[model samples]
Target: MTTRISAVPRPAPAVDLAVPFADCHITSDAQAAVLRVLQSGWVTTGREVAAFETEFAAAVGAEYAVAVSSCTQGIELALRSLGLPPGSLVLSSTMTFCGAVQAIMHAGHQPVLVDVDPATGLPTPATVRTAVQAFGRPAALTVVHWAGDVADVPALAEAAGVPLDHVVVDAAHALGTYAGDAPVGSGPGATCFSFYATKNLPLGEGGMITTDDAARADWLRKARLHGMTADAWRRYLPGGSWRYNVADAGLKANMTDIQAAMGRAQLTHFPSWQRRRAQIAAQYDEQLAGLPGVGLPHRPAPGQGTHAWHLYPIRLRLNGGIDRDEVIAALSERAIGTSVHFIPVHRLAYFSQAALIPSAGLTGADALFGQLLSLPMYPRLSGAQVDAVCAAITGIAHQGISGKGTE
Candidate 1:
């Protein structure tokens, strides 16, 4: 069956309001939770953080959860907890945020970059095997769930000849995501999640780490707060002693009660938000699927797990004479916001000059980078807004095909 979008150009909609690439949706319950924290007299990591950790663990089907100040620190802490020797190599995708790579460095390890599947922007088992062959076996593997799509961490680890315990997931875009029947955090490694202002569960700033290992969970608890024998809540609260000891030098990356409170409230509304995100993604898939020169986001196979839809990234077939940036400008002109998912970590100036080794040719990531375009994706985005964005894109596709050049 031949599938194609009409060649006729749709008139650009009136630009009364500009759609933002990302926006935070704070519910009234979230506001109340934050307010309660502000009035509690205890604002730092305490009871609220503990309760949030418990709830979050249950939400993600993990045995234990540790709240952190940021996803970067969560990755660093998870890597450090592994007790790997300093300067040990860690395998990660080249098509990921630089912060994840920096986390490996922060944990006193060298990063070995690996190529990704061009279509999904995720590393496959074959790519992991190639990296292992080129850079020798790494002490650990940090797999990123790019754009809310889950990567098979256990499989990737096996391919790299690394154990499941050595796998760490940079799940910044994958909180509600799943792998088969299990939630992302329920997998083999320490999975880290983000709650940045633009993330699905926005708390202004926060992160979480989930693991099944009790010992590691305990280590993470103390490690997040300077390896203290007892946190502030334990020392200052009733029936608590003032004495404490620092077991190991650790990062001050504990999440505060304020953030935890907001996180809990956000969790309450998370299911509905996830549904809305999926709906928006479906709208894009339906509208943009048959458009010439437009490649829709990758959809996971049945039973592979559901995408969290953190980003609605589409690829442009640049060979069709449609420039990705030009299309971006056209969307901007129509008050439709868009952004690139990432600039490959290796391409960044710091990483380019760093000691990081590319285990294999990064042709896949490199090719996907030039064509990537992330459209506005958030829980609060209305259906009308989605239609407008799709319309603008459709118009751009038609123009490009006719050699009008997105002018």
Candidate 2:
């Protein structure tokens, strides 16, 4: 039986407006899609999920795509499928979400943090070389498409002296990102994408792993569903039997049909959303240009690749009179929310253990961490909100400092 809920109305706040750093766009079609799934009675990984996987694979130009519960699980499943020996070293960026390092560790590997490019907060070919030169050859590397800017995969592989197959891309922020003539997932390595609430293609909470390797694809299919030879839908089909076989012990990381329905709806509307995001990014670039002591996010020249515009991370000149935290507080006071993209992985208490990641060599990451701040960015963010955000920032730059800047 369905329970009826009563509506509750509240008075508006005293502030002009409250602008969040990011917001999900849930279309009417998305709501209907979820309702259809709920009415279908088959809410697990079934027809809806199968269709989403197929359509998503085609969109990303990949041979196969496996939907998972989250990008973190997708990364772990990809790494586990590699069959790497225990204690294998996985080189990853220092300026990235904890999910990457946690995935490496969960997949029975040790994470060696690599410094990022000081300008863009991304790991470069030189960063890979430095990691290899310092830590010796890693069994695999987990490269992030930092803030949706495509990494130079070929150059990075050559520098690391590893084949392209040894790399797994954490493209959590890169759904519409392109690398040359191909999409981000249409490469030699496994690519993981997030559908978190704040991500480009928000599905509330889900992820996908795409790869061209048929063997790995097949393995991941089974690995995401408890290593069963056949999924529940397949077994329950008309001519199918309930019998199945266990291949290997796998984690439970399958995406439900309800989530897939939401994803499918979002996919249909993705192009328009992407276009709006790009437009907003352009406005930020034009309006926020040459603001004293502020560095805009790095954008690639035309034909190099396309950025997904997942974040607009601006660097605060820490040595300048204003401080990053003070700026954040000032913006908050103006009813706008800002966030820091990351704290260097080396500084985190768990990862700080000398055994996991040595802290001495992460000079670039450490330096970038103190300066980075993520401005409000999302498809639905209005021109007026963007204007107010910029004005608040400019005002803070003028008079936000109370004393010498905090390093």
Candidate 3:
């Protein structure tokens, strides 16, 4: 029996085309929460934000959580909170989103790009040691949990010869990620998470910074709100003191009550959504495995770690004469959306001049960049849609090295 996928009808194939690379998962509950917040008079960083901070911190096994406008700001705030001297070196992954490096720069640190492991496309302890050898002791090291897979933070910290506190995790894709028995933010380093529209637990545009240090958490609270000793919610509320002073020259990046309301609702239903994401990934793995030159998202063996499955990225084997761009175009023509995870930071115009702290060339990053493609992976994506996506990928793979459809 042939399974039919329900999607917008297209003129050519008689099958509806256009599957987005990613979509926001907002249920009626989420919608109601947002509406309630809108109706409530206290709409800016009030009860909803406070509740979200508390709940999210507990959920991630962190001592404290500070809500912010975006993960980029959270990264910058975490860096600034360290009070590193100007021009201090900060080793960062070359394979991450540009915002990670930009945050380091915004915090007045010089970023030294480091290579990533070819298999997982994440920086390993060996890479950290290599970077430390090439560059002197960095004031800090920023590691990204690429594609929601937890990086070996403890080992990397040890290799960098830095205390765990000196390591900052760019966990933008790893809200539910775990390492061994602990969650991503449960570790010693500051873990920053994103709530972007396309993220796993998005609230349109917000972020959270989770850490174990009480002092740092307190400082970040002030720093996120223009360095004010007290936020407006406190001042405007009854019996609250209006006499407050600026603590630090902080950036305006506080999360609003509206965003937090949506976040709160999403957090409540996160477990089920997460399970669906894992299921979709497993389905893709089962169907797409052994397709000529195509690669699928990697999963750790049981008891190893938990992958958040934020993005299901596949690599096209260049040796098979697969042109990634051409395949992307073919998918697009079929109404299947796709994207590249990232172009290496060193290759970007902004970071082109950045020095690479390498024992070897950035060949690993470059190699990964050449073939990586992100497929749609969201909780709302139906099983039939998953099948359609897999079918499309399989069809493309069977087209042979020439990229000509076998049909």
Candidate 4:
């Protein structure tokens, strides 16, 4: 039987919008998983860590999943393993988080900034081509399922060429997202996933690296644990001796058994949690589409695939005398929690001329940033909450611009 979210009617204009956007739902199973790890007495990397790696790899259709301390480390190792030379162009969208840019620089690479589609703040294959031309190389591109629209990676790869090196995906938002039947990491190249507390899969602060290449996987394993050859042997095996070689100067970036324990539990509940996310998204689709100047998140084209709905952001048009920031503040006044998905990396202090991200101008990125707003979207959000959100949006919108373009 298809599970459908019930209809959430618009609330009266006087009532406080009782619905907030997101709430993380952790089950007793998650507690049990953690307890098992505690009782095992091995809190650091151990059997639980290995099990997490195995299960996560299988979930994303990757040959290997190396658990790491954070998504930054995952991205950092992915770049180091891709064998891209120093200062090679690492292309990423300015429409994403600053961490993506910061991680590339940390891995000793130059960030080639790509602009996003004005309509959706997504870097399409063509936009990537523009950035590549500016850099004059087969630059490393980080594909984002920005707001869960899986960019055309197949066409992107075909046009860019196969055996594509340095194509690391910042799949922080793409755990359950699918392109046809294939998830983000299922495609060519390495993919990084975050298990940040707010992510669909919460493990407090953890991450995983996905790759199909055995040699590359091995190197990442070493790099993620301080570039030493003895991590698995010295720490994991008893009486195996501590003598082992160091590959390179690495960092302490390994995920603990405790964190992996949570990952294992999340995997168990993700199926139902993901279904709830889908049902909630479906309701948003029907309700938000009717509101003016409110452009809802994009869905995959027919046969394109499924979206994980990591965020439920709506772009409110600003041509109507009211600014996007004004709408957000008004929502806050009405007890609705909202956020901007990003501030567009190009606008950051790091990238503002000091860093100099290439674009004819930052025209495309700045345009998109002015209108975006991320509504709450965690699995625990109730149907009643969804209705309150919709009502607050409509109310704030009408008061701001009358749901019609500014006169």
Candidate 5:
């Protein structure tokens, strides 16, 4: 008997047809927005940034929304406004980006760690309680809404037993996610929303800090750049003096009017963009169901809150013959791209030692990390492309053997 070779090869599992991840989806509105800023001549920190700040605050239902260069800077500035004593503990959930931890550290405070809800990988009342018990009374609490899922924000704030001022939300992923009738920023001390290249309201790079407190808002606006008593826009306005006061030493983190122009354009498309994201997420949920080793990203109940669908993170189930890594590799081979929402702030080498990780002593972050996988999700992602990605996942998920390639 001779072994014969077949001429036709296996169709590389339908060559990944999913649309590229991180598509900015800038519309014709972007051109007009940019042109308006350009035509004004006075770009940099001008009327555009100020206008964007005002509009964004109104959009988020906050009394004030200050624009900044980046979400990390926004978080830092928010923490600085808190003015907690140096070395004081600033508690925050562990299952989050390193920026939150970096903000706390740079604020000259001790970062205390808190774990998140086991199922959703979001902060919960219990996690907050445990953090308080473990880390003691913190100078403040940094509440993070990871993966666009609003955590038990109110509950966590209540459990902390601190005044509302102690709450500072790193809501980079919650620009559009809401709890109850309020968006992520409302009812908390301050919530920082990102407008990064991959965010729901991508603006190349920018962020907003929404707050109800007038004093804090004023301080943040001043603190973003050298703690000047007045902003550059004010100085350059007609009849305004170049003379200004530096109340405190601040960092250079102000957002330019050009970036704000992009923000304004993105905001116009926000409602439709979010709808598209939700639809894509729903499609993923429907198409990926019952695929072995793959669990669709959990969605919060509509009555409980509004979900922005900033990320569609599926946890690769270990029991499935195909593990997370193998499936991810298979998807990669087909051209579908993916990323882990986070590696857990405490786990990152940059903030490892002496860092306050919300899940420091627990297995919470570790458990969440072991199986997490974020699928490509964006307004530009097409229905057919979504289907192709889902089909690839479906095939890989069903294959027997739990491989580590998913995350």
Candidate 6:
């Protein structure tokens, strides 16, 4: 039998949740790992951080991994490491976080916005080619893997006429995401992953860059820690040297051992966490499949690799007299939180006047922006909670059809 919200609206059950759009899942082991770091005396970037890097690199099939303070910093460092000339142009999707564009500016380059595919909310090879045609060839292409869906970086680079090494993947939403047979980070160019509180790997605050380039990895390591030859662990440990040199001026974006310890512990449970995420996404797919004026998220094809399901975004068909904001407010009344993935970069204040190569028209991104609505998604969410969320949506959708829409 199909679940439905009661017309009488019964009292809230004990398990009834004010479900937030995102929630951090912290295990006992993760807490213990943090405690161990607190008692270890050396809590800065040290053995724990080093070990985390090695293990993370192996997990993603990358030759090297450099941990940083945030994904934004990782993107900046990755861009700077490229040794691209000043004032160079970089191509990126308009339907992405502002940080990705800011990173290009931080690296002393200009950003050229490309329209995304409305269905996937990611820039396609055709879009990349069109952007390049409009604003000369870019020095690099920064592809944002939107909502845990991996973008075809190789094809996008080829379309942009940029080398594979010149491709930088803003994979902040993609941790468990895969590309073909290999993981996302294993692919060409520098791929950045976020370990924020809401991310797949919840380290509270940290990011990592994975790449196969040894020279770039070495540069990133020093660049993340003020270009110092040795970090605190190398200088303060027994039988270590105090003499150090600053090879280049760099930002202080090093990840602490405390975060790294938590990350290591989180990594141990990551596989199971990923499986749970997939299960939750499947439940959403089945439950919300045929609702009128409700558009489900795009599914990946056979060889496109698996989606990480970071954000379960659905589109509202506005022509059916349904307002996205109204739906959000109704869901809020039911104590179910929701969000919008992003507003196009061009629409933002800073970016509107910034030195960005404006696209002819961000048709796809513009269309998708109006209807985008992200539902609650997290590993700890119960099946009943999922059903409740779906039932609430179904009721609202039916109400719209009957001319009783939430206005």
Writing each residue's lDDT as its tens digit, candidate 2 over 102-199 gives 99998989888888888878888887877887778888888888888878878877777777888888999889888877789987879999999999
lDDT by residue (1-407, candidate 4, tens digit) is: 22111224534564444555555556688788889889987788878888999999998899988899988888888887876788877777788888888888888888777787877677776776676666665546666778766777656554444345457878888889888988878756888999888788988889998888888888888888878886763555767766778857676899988888888988898888889989988888888887777888877878988888889878887334677777776676666778898898878878765344655866777887888889878888888888888887776555554434233
The better-scoring model by TM-score among 2 and 6 is 6
Candidate 3 per-residue lDDT over residues 1-407, each given as its tens digit: 21122233444753444687878778789899888988887789998999999999999999999999999999999999998899998989899999999999999889988888777898887777778888887888898889998788877777777778988899999988888778888767688999999999977799999999999999999999999999999898899998999958899999999899899889989999899999999999999988878887765668978999998999887334547887787777677888988898988876877655465767789888888999989998888888888898776666554434222
Q: What does the lDDT read for residue 385 in candidate 2?
A: 93
TM-score of 4: 0.90
Greater TM-score among 3 and 4 belongs to 3
Each prediction's whole-model lDDT (CA)? 0.88, 0.84, 0.85, 0.77, 0.79, 0.88
Q: Which stretches of candidate 5 lie over 4 Å from their true place?
A: 1-18, 318-321, 357-360, 401-407
The TM-scores, one per candidate, come to: 0.94, 0.93, 0.93, 0.90, 0.91, 0.94
Pick the winner on TM-score between candidates 3 and 5: 3
Stretches off by above 4 angstroms in model 1 are 1-17, 318-320, 405-407
Model 1 vs. true fold: TM: 0.94
Candidate 4 least-lDDT 10 residues: 1-10
On a 0 to 1 TM-score scale, where does candidate 5 land against the true structure? 0.91
In candidate 1, position 401 carries an lDDT of 68
lDDT score for residue 194 of model 2: 98
Candidate with top lDDT is 1
| Candidate 6: tens digits of C-alpha lDDT, residues 290-396 | 98889999867999788998888999873346578877867876888889999999889898778464447888999999999999888998898899999988887
